[model samples]
Target: MNEIEKKIVDQFDVAKAWSHVQHLVEKLPGRYTGSDQERQSAEFIAARLREIGIEPQIQPVDSWLGVPDGATMRIEAPEPIDIPCAPDTGRGQLISGEFIVIETPEEARQLAGKLTGKIVVIPYSYSYPITPEEARKQGAAGMIYGNWGPSDVDILRVTAPQTWTYWGLPDPDAFRIGEQEAIPQGHIGRQSYERVRDLCRKGKVTGSFSANIRSFWGKSHQVIADVGPDHLGDDADFMIMAAHHDSWNPGASDDGGGVAVLLEAARVLHGARQSLKRKVRFMFVSGHENGAYATSTWYLDNHWQALREHAICFSFTDNPGFANAPEFKIEANEELMDFALACARDVVGDEPKINVHRANKTADRGFFGVGVPGIYTRGAFTQAQADAWGGAFLGYWNHSNHDTLDKIDPVNLERNARIRLLEAVRLCSAEILPYDFRRTVAGMRERLEGWQADGRYDVSGTLALARKFAEHLDAFYGPAGTRDAARTNETLKALARELSWINYTYKGRYGQDIFGVDLKKPLPIMNSIDELAHHAAGSPMDLMLRARIRRDQNKVEDALRASIALVTSS
Candidate 1:
């Protein structure tokens, strides 16, 4: 690496980085999807990216963060009760009606009597979380739920140090009461639920609910910036370093820390542009907390072709601070599991207990929808802390108003950023790509086997598909040296491994094991590799392509869902 690259890589000032992130916390007023708070946050990021001499762009999004017109609920049995409800960023149609009572979904199923003018209530079950989904399943006009389980608060805190980041409030949206069936709904905690349930038990039970929501169509933005040489030739592939700029919760541990790391890393990279062999693009995205991934979705639609041809994607967000939790872990691109291990070793140096696992099947990477592999670093808290306060990985406070700068520790931010900076630099500057194949293949085979055992799939076709992919994997990695051979070998191997993970792990069987696809897949996965890859040699085109893929992968997901539905039906 040249002097400039060295200096840029070395410029991660912990204190200044923390200050930058701290300042941003005040600007983020609420959930990332809607509200002026989110818009201001996006603008600040764009300004910073522009200051770095990179063209910053804005993207309009349908933030479900609609202005709350109002909502009310009334029960006309025994004693009348009034309840409060709020609009979720993930919007649902307005609904108002009397509530209908059903014993179970099966009972509700048998009594599928017209509910166009009624809300639905089924007794709470031990499986309360899934109960709303069940209610939606039963074709209820809308849901008025009473929980049987405890509702606990989730707390998040981080101790990492880096640049400025915005912390904002969580979306006040209700749970997935409607995503499954476009129904309006509301839930009451266990304590309050008992009163409602007791009243329902009385002979005459009647309830009415109504919601009025005001929403505006506007644009949001995703900012992209770059560093190092502009023309690195077709043979080079960049390692993309990324983070989502918007937040839910003050977003301190959730991503303010991650954003700080990205800015600090970018500052270093921009300062030392000459030594980079490949390009490094920094992406600050919005819409992560709502719309699932509006910004990344937009990027994929616009830039996926480039992603397919020239890049490796990496992303960082969420709590990358304190490491004293049960086990500070790293989720890696399964195909390059060993490669990630090698990089991690370089940064923490023999921290044997830094548990590493396969990617969580989805995150920002899945938006790329292809074989692009990425990682979701483990939350920064210990097991005990996670149990008590909820760790960095989407705790109760994640999108709540609780995500503030006060929850973060400067020391934790500094350590995590330094680790990421080193990782990114190594990847960007390395001569020989370090992505591993055998281990990834092993992981895939294991996954395929599990799917077969589940009997939920027609193993024949999917298994055949898996074998073909494995063959491609073997062919891609066969070449040992020679520039073209090595480049193709490395890139294809990495792509195949990631694609394999995306196809098999992200959706099919592996994803099913982890609830539904509630997470964006591409960006987070890319963030995992961005830090280390940049420290070595990386390609900007590669980074750009990943950004595009991060935006485009949804098509694949849609297709996959269609195909899977067909298979299951057959």
Candidate 2:
């Protein structure tokens, strides 16, 4: 690290950041969306921003949320027995049906006709092959998610709420199904899951599940502030640093640590504002745990034009600074992977193990569809540790009452904050933005070629476009040093917007995909490539897919052409 970088890193006070985390976790427990505690947390964050001479804007956003109250489950068949359970954010109601364990979505589909009025028990994984909406459509009466962790008596899991609409909670379509028609859902521990499975092996098992939750539309606050020069005016090019402030059950690690990191980074960056060439927008969003990124979605919708025109990149922090997690994990888009990895190596020495992954559909990732390249950094357990703990990410205590202040380590917290500060300073102060489109095009070509090898569909034209784009990247970046920095940066940003739109989103630039649906594949629109083989040629389904592919082909080709035009024009 250089002298300036070292000086900025030294300015981050670990004690101050830890104090913030302690305050949030201890004084304000249960910072659920739209709750009084959440509002107070926003106020607390805003006050901190003001203390550092940055005026904060606390914007109110109306969102629909389901807050869990309590839940119950009982087996009322041959022998009456009560099972311990925790409620997901499904609707509140009592429903009884025959207990049927369907391990996978395909199994549920195979047993479609028999699923009506049946309570389906599905095992919990990171990504669900079948969602509650699909289960509802298949005529299932209720749902129970079997926790993936150990059968320890202390652990009870409640996951983030299920949302069918895009960007979560704001869409009118999400409310199209009335509460009367909604299905009740909850989670049972592994021991309960084993007992239920054994009971199902017997002749027939009848079970009753109920969840008491309060679902309503209310207002939540988002605290936003900017640190840097004002001379660039309204269309100033800026980068975003954001974290969600609301979390479940004294969520010290899930987001309290993230909030603390953002605060400390902002304070340190404010002192170096005069050295920055671009603005740094700090957003403390709400409604992540319960409302599914409602406030972040609100910002995207309200500021769509500005974000598309001037936003450079998006960086988010979540679930950082775990006590026993020695491994550093960096999740970034291909465009920013190289830069982000270098920053990680700077913070944690190059000798330590660092895990690199592609960005996914979590951690307030509302910026993806907006065409902003993003990066997320966190401390994570190694593979062996994760396996020993029953595959929990941070720990089995995640999103539970056990996520208390004891889970945070001061040393790890300082390391996380230092990494955030380095990334922010370099991104804001660099004369030329650090983005490599070559890496992006290489990934695109790989995905397209893999699809082409499948022989299910002809992606030759798209593959050619990707190759053509790749050939021009060297020439595009060759003259960057001698060119006008502002013009060159603008061209790169515009190209990124187009490439990210096609690479990350299937809904194009204007719409949002349904929340919690995995779109991790490169060029997610082409995911339909495998589906074409399922239907006979010239059948209705096949013809429909053909039409959709043609449109998507046009989308990809047009984006590549635009990218080419950008490079050549610059």
Candidate 3:
């Protein structure tokens, strides 16, 4: 290891850091998003950053900060069946009708004629959840949904009142149908629904339901923060570290963990300002739990120029406590992969036991859709524990309220924090930044090709557009060094910042109907940016470039396949 790397390893304080993280975790429950508690938590983090010699800024978020008013759901049955339901966040209107039973898509197509004005109950398939858009498109007035399992304990019953999250994406057609202000929806357990289906197959299965849901409530907020070196020169780039601060019931794993990591990062980096060669900025975001609309969209609009200058952003989130369990490799922007892998070596050490994902699935890294590569560091649960509890199979309490800090292991958190800290420091001080354009190109091509292979899209035109975007990336490459470092750094930072804004907006508001062209038409631009991230390390991009290069590249088939992958969950 290099002299600096060896020193960083020596300075890592595992036990002390663990104690500090525990203290922070204990104080987190009081800081649920949108409440005064949340604001207080932000202040505390900012104060800590200041003490470490870094100036912290609070990025204001656009949010509806208040208790969601009345909610309700009801079945206006001729003879009521005792089933439970609740008012989803933003619901409206109430319409009553008899339930129509359909067993297959064929049945749905046939019943479409009569189902338009009636409620519909289709058997729940083992794969895929029932989506509202599909039901609406099929001409159903209301829905009686069924899931794969029985109703587990309803944890929401005990959550602190006045707590709520972003209810899906914003929609003007949104409505509610229930006893209180709730959506007109209900779910029957797997066994109960199967029984209902059998009864319907034998004969008539009819029931009526309605919901009196309320209209839209107050607005929501999105907070942002920008702090870094004032001058790194025009071509000098930056390393961005980010995470969402909001939560779903204290959101310990989904993002509370991420917030804490960023806080500690800012503290350490700000304290070691003299050794830094590149600029560092930290973003403590909100609304990621609700789908990243407010912060992601607003950032794109308000600071498009700044984002274009960002080098790369590292995202920290989820139950870092699972580090002791089976190791899943790091799948990140290829340019950043080596840095991540190196940090893994330094922090994770050599291990024959676990796999690492370099080109892994995307997270907000996917959100950086603009191609600026970023990393999501959340350790998964032990293989045995995960297998025993299917939920744990996906790393436990994903969106559930049980994501408390108590669930985290101090050793796990300390290891995760060290890896993140070293990665950030190493990247900032590296002689050559670590972005890989070729791999990024390959990744985008893969995504496009995957979409077309699914047979659902005719996006050949997008491929042609993608190649053209690749050219823009080729024209932008420049050499890095200390003499030009100051100017080069500023240039890189400006571009990273601007790229961040563009990608944020692009991801948040891509599919929305914008001006005639559907603005998201430029997805390739962001994809190309991710390619540049891969070029960061001094290593030749050629050897590592073939990882995702598909020999059979078909645009139409690839586009369709990519589209389907976006919808179907594994």
Candidate 4:
């Protein structure tokens, strides 16, 4: 590691971070987005920024949020038995009906016909736990949601509460639902699911629930504080180091640990700010748990010009620390990832297995919508390990009350802090940003190949473009390091910006983070090409379908050709 980065790494203290997380998780209750606890959490983080001598700014975020009242669910048959319902915001949403249960999407597809005549019961497993929208077409009354803990024990899960799109943000006339719109729903524990499922096998099991979930317009926030010189050279680019502060219950691993790393990152960088070559902005964003991506989205949309001129975001979430034995990942092309990993390897000595995601999914989802190149990192474990750790499948403690401060280890926390700190330093301090577009070309090709395997479509159109882009990128990253830094950075940014617009926005513009575009995973641009080809050949309406698919195929082909020209000609 460079002398200055080494100094910053040595300065990081996980103990200090632990104290902060302890206060955030232990002293505080669940910090759901827009809750009083979340507001206080923002203030607390801002206060810490001040403690480190960085003036903090509290940026406002508006959202649609479900304010909880009370809820109850009970089985009327097989003798009346009460089942605990977690807090939700479906005011006066009461229902009584027979039910259908599903654990995975395949199961739901298999039972689609049966699912229509009853209340759909689904377990909280993947990111989405709601009854599939397709179920409504059949005629289901509503839904009874069940949450299972890592263990076999029944776990009560309270979801991030936002009914309308963009979490709780105000919507346009066409966009507004006017109220919480969905099949009326409430949650029960795992044991409740087993009981109801067992009774159904014997005979019909009818159930009743009253979801008194409430919601209103409330303010969420983003806390941004920077550590570095006020003025930088014209060529110098700034970097954003980010993590979410709000949590469900004591969200130690879900992001309390991540926030702790950001805190330590700021303090460590603050110490070496003068010597550093570039500016670093430390952001603790909210509205993640509730699904708005409120702060990150606001930043991307509201500050587009500034971000476009010069900014790359490095976001942190759900860090499992060293003990979790989690994997490291980045969405950028290979050169950038390699540079960052080399920096990380210098410190922790390769204990972390880092990989570059070919087709990006969830991570700092806020930035991609607005065209900023972003990198996200986290610590994760398998379901078995997560279960043992009292963590849900996706994270150690995703959205449960059990994610307390006890999950943290001081030494491991610092190690995580080290990985983030060094990467941010390199991005900020490097005169020429170390990014390569060939990785983008390569990643897209990989996704296309996967899609080809999934469905038989002639992807040669997309494949041809990927090859051309690859050739140009190879020319840009010269074998002798003879490329101009300024030109390379600008070209790479432009490519990523266009790619983001096409993948994440409507008409290559803005839309909802979750609904507007694919947030967790950005599918291939020609994702359905092969499927359309196969359908044209196999379907009864082959003539019409082929004609229509050809038109779209030509349009996408032209767009890809244009994008290739941008890099190739430049």
Which candidate number maximizes lDDT?
2
TM agreement with the true structure for every prediction: 0.67, 0.94, 0.64, 0.85
Error of 1 at 61 (Å): 5.8
lDDT of 2: 0.82
| Best TM-score among the predictions, by candidate number | 2
| Predictions: Cα RMSD each | 12.2, 2.3, 11.0, 3.9
Per-residue CA lDDT of model 4 for 1-570, tens digit only, reads 867778777888878988888888777667877778898888899899889888999987776556556788888886789888875435666778886666665676566567655778776554443343455556776677666553366767766545323422546641343343455667777667777767776887887887776665667778998778656654456788888887777777778888888887888888788777678877898877763566776777776777877775544545547355565554443335566567656866866566555324343455554566666554445445656634354442346675666566676677667877888877777766776656555666776666557655556776687777788777766663666767766776676665654443333335543432323333333334543543446677565555655554464466567667777766
Model 2 residue 528 lDDT score: 73
RMSD of 3: 11.0
lDDT of 3 by residue, 13-69 (tens): 555455445545566564444555556566766776676666666665554232323
Model 3 clash tally, residue pairs: 104
Error of 4 at 239 (Å): 2.1
Q: What TM-score does candidate 4 reach? A: 0.85
Expressed as tens digits, the lDDT of each residue in 1-570 for candidate 1 is: 345434554577887678667867765645355657767776777777667776666666543333334455677665677754433212445455556666553555455546545676643332222234444555556765443333342121111100001111112332222223345555444345445556656655566665443444445556777676766664556666777766655677667777777877787777666666667777777666544455655565566555655566465555666434334567766555666565555545665357676565333444334445565554354545544431223343444456667666676666566556656666666665566555654554555565457543223444554455556545545665554644444555334534553444433212221223222233232222232322233467455645544443443343334433322232
Error of 4 at 325 (Å): 4.8
Worst 10 residues of 4 by lDDT: 515-524
Choose 3 or 4, whichever is better by lDDT: 4
> Ranking under TM-score, best-scoring first?
2, 4, 1, 3
Ranking by lDDT: 2, 4, 1, 3
**lDDT-superior candidate, 2 or 3:** 2
lDDT of each: 0.52, 0.82, 0.48, 0.65
